[model samples]
Target: MRDVKACRVCRSPLPRAGRGRPPAYCSRACQAKAYRRRKNPPVPTPAASRRPGRRRQIAEALWRIAAERGLDAASMREIAAEARVSLRVVQYHFDGKHELLLAALAMLNADNERRARARMATVDVDDPRELLRAILDEFLPVDEQRLLALRVFAAYFARSLVDPELAAVFLHDGQPLEELVATVLTDFGGIPDPRREADLLVSGITGLGMDVVHGRRTLAEVRATIAYHLDRLGGTGKVPGAEAPGTAVV
Candidate 1:
């Protein structure tokens, strides 16, 4: 005798058959119900799908504290408070404050990089001046988001001076940003010494960005300064009567 089978949906015993293939459902209704279930699955709960990780929540709390009150204020207990979690929860996610700080920096850098690329995608990449500007713009406090990032950057830079671990984060890219600037200068800007000009441009923008964060320089003043340097480096490659580089800040 052949072994009996149960319906996949209703668990009813399937009728024994004499043919080569055995049926899965006892009746057409059961088969149809199973098919319907497969076609239209239940939706997942919003919390189940959209919940942020505990580590990220803690890291973001650090970012907010760093931006608003400097990194010194971002103690473990303070971070947990900012995140509305217990201090033990913050400790659970990060081994220590150093690790949490590094994570926040990494996340900030990654987010800025992604946004910079997105911004560049909307522009004409063949225009080297525009491309370079796009890259440099990411470093400046052009808007609220960049403003927060620059604050964190300034705090980290100061701390990195005495802390080897934090300093490593600054040096992680191995001069890649400078190399990219040099490439753009050589290929499109047609500068005589691309590498030298790249170093100057990158450092100049960084200093100017920091100045803005310090409240010593206005955004307009920094743009004018940047425009002056771009003109001097011959990176602007401007034609007669064309608008000046960095004139209208993005």
Candidate 2:
């Protein structure tokens, strides 16, 4: 039996008669109108066909390839293959591997910053404990996605160390976190040399992240280690050791 349906052309609530042909239009006139409309469908603009957008699609392809196979494998041909686009298309968007990697780095950094900002949006910067916690949380790879991002960082940073041009860009991007660490230390660490302490803390946290990523240590261990160091810095409020906040640097 034909099921109940609306007329395709007029949508006039036409019901199906028992054991009859399905109506494409409400009436003969509606059917003629529908045929005319079909023959003159509006043509979509070029921008409309660029739905997801080419630049984003290329970035996504490169990011996915780098994440899965490491940056070394994210070549122009490989990225083009991954995105199901031609090599010339990929090259049209990005000049070469370095430029592609830089774009990826920028995207990854922006994503991380966006997430961290959202997470710390309501954090009390004046509160020493809260500030320190937020700062540390931003650095920690608490989830698998974050750990994957770290791999991207590792790839670029390693390359940057040897290439001064890349190093300049990398260092500039890294300064914000370093400054944040310094601020937290100055306000909470209770140590005289907050700048030095900040550097040390950053170094320590970086190592802890490495261990966690390499599976040598767990997230629990990382937290424990951080807490231990923070306590030494007297982050709870007052300095704990025999050192004064100004005179004796703990």
Candidate 3:
């Protein structure tokens, strides 16, 4: 038997029992650093012909199809055709229809949240009320991303009513919104019952979003309606330039 080669980083004897290529590093840390360097090596962007992985490319194509047509309308065969892969390839990556839909929903939500966080970072409001307003407004159907997300969420919510597992995931995703509203009520609005207020705010937001998604109301109308309720709750007291109805006390 030939002698085993030592790891380049740690000088440890490489394992000869592995099924595949011999690792260049003895441990994960050195492996990660090496991967990072290789990934970011001074290669020109135009010369880099590396494309998205098959799974990622498929997922992206499916997302585009889903965004144009509802998920129910986007069949697996059509998605496979759009992704330029075999239908079996899609199935191999995802367990089933529901799992694929769940993955798509998760990816869409994550991308939306990332964009929302980036937009929120640009806001430098000192007042918590204004900050809350900015954050909440980001969820409204004011743009293509928000509108698409609202549409997808509404579809999932309607479907979740009949599917237990989907319902579980929906509830898990909604927890963050509830917590955000609770924080804003307690810290910014100075509400005595933050939990109750948070629930109410979440309910209102959900209802408004549904209405917008269904085309029952325009985004500006929904914003105005929410502003009316918010003015009564915390806006009048906390947000400047917001006046209380039937109050002479400025």
Candidate 4:
């Protein structure tokens, strides 16, 4: 005698259809409902998801504090209050301000890198000047989010002045970018000293961002400056009316 099977959903006795296979559910409707329940369960989200959300809240609080006030103002207690979590919660995710600073920096850098990658995807990598323009645009504070992020960056730089560990993190963050840009300059600009050019361009782009943040220049003027600099570098003269190698367009 064959064993009787019950429906997975309604627990009703199941009648097998033909000799091919045993029925897991009594009816198609029951099977679909069961599958739907399995797919979209009513249970609360797992703790893993909630934990990251809490961590993000704390990090965002830290970012805001760093940007609005200073990193010094991002003490654990203040972060707890800002994040609306317990001080222990903040301490649980991050041992101290250094760890919190690193977390916030990771978030900030991730955002910047995401934007940079997206922009680079659409740009012409074969054209070095355009590539540099795409890369440096990510460095600029063209809009509100970038502006706030740059403010947070300013706060972090000031804090890193005295903290060697923070300085190390800053260097770690920048070294890869320098290497990448140097490689690009080597390929596109026919520059002999790619590293030197990369360093200069990185610093120059940073200064341009700072200038924009400080009201020293408009974003269009910044783009024009970048174009002028890249034009001097002279990748390929594909675009019409491109500036000459020695000329500064603006």
Give Cα-based local distance difference scores for all models: 0.77, 0.72, 0.70, 0.78
In the range 67-182, model 1's lDDT, one tens digit per residue, is 88888888898899999988766654566888778877888898888888888889778877677777888889999989888888888887888889789877586898899999
TM-score of each: 0.70, 0.68, 0.65, 0.69
Cα deviation of 232, candidate 2, in Å: 1.4
lDDT tens digits by residue: candidate 4, 14-133:
665567666787889998987887787755732232367778888889888888998888888998999998876776576577777887799888877887778789998887666777
Q: In lDDT terms, how accurate is model 4?
A: 0.78
Candidate 2 per-residue C-alpha lDDT over 1-250 given as tens digits, one digit per residue, 9 for 90 to 100: 4554777654567765656566666789988977876786645832232333675688778777766676678888988888898886666566677776776678778888898888787998778766776778666679876887776677766777778977877778556666777877777644667777788778778877877888899989888877766777764434456455444343
Kindly indicate the candidate among 1 and 2 with the higher TM-score. Answer: 1
Between prediction 2 and prediction 4, which has the larger lDDT?
Answer: 4
Model 3 agreement with the true structure over 1-250: per-residue lDDT tens digits = 4444766544566777465555667789878866876777736642243343775666666676766676666688888898898876776566577877777777777788899889888777566666767777876788877877777676666678888988897767547777887777676554567777778777777787778777898988977867765665673334444464434331
RMSD of each: 14.4, 14.1, 11.2, 14.6
The residue ranges of model 2 lying beyond 4 angstroms of the native Cα positions read 1-53, 235-250
Enumerate clash totals for all models, in the order shown: 0, 0, 0, 0
Look at candidate 3 and tell me the lDDT of residue 178.
76
Model 3 accuracy (lDDT, Cα): 0.70
Q: Which run of 10 residues does model 2 get worst, by summed lDDT?
A: 43-52
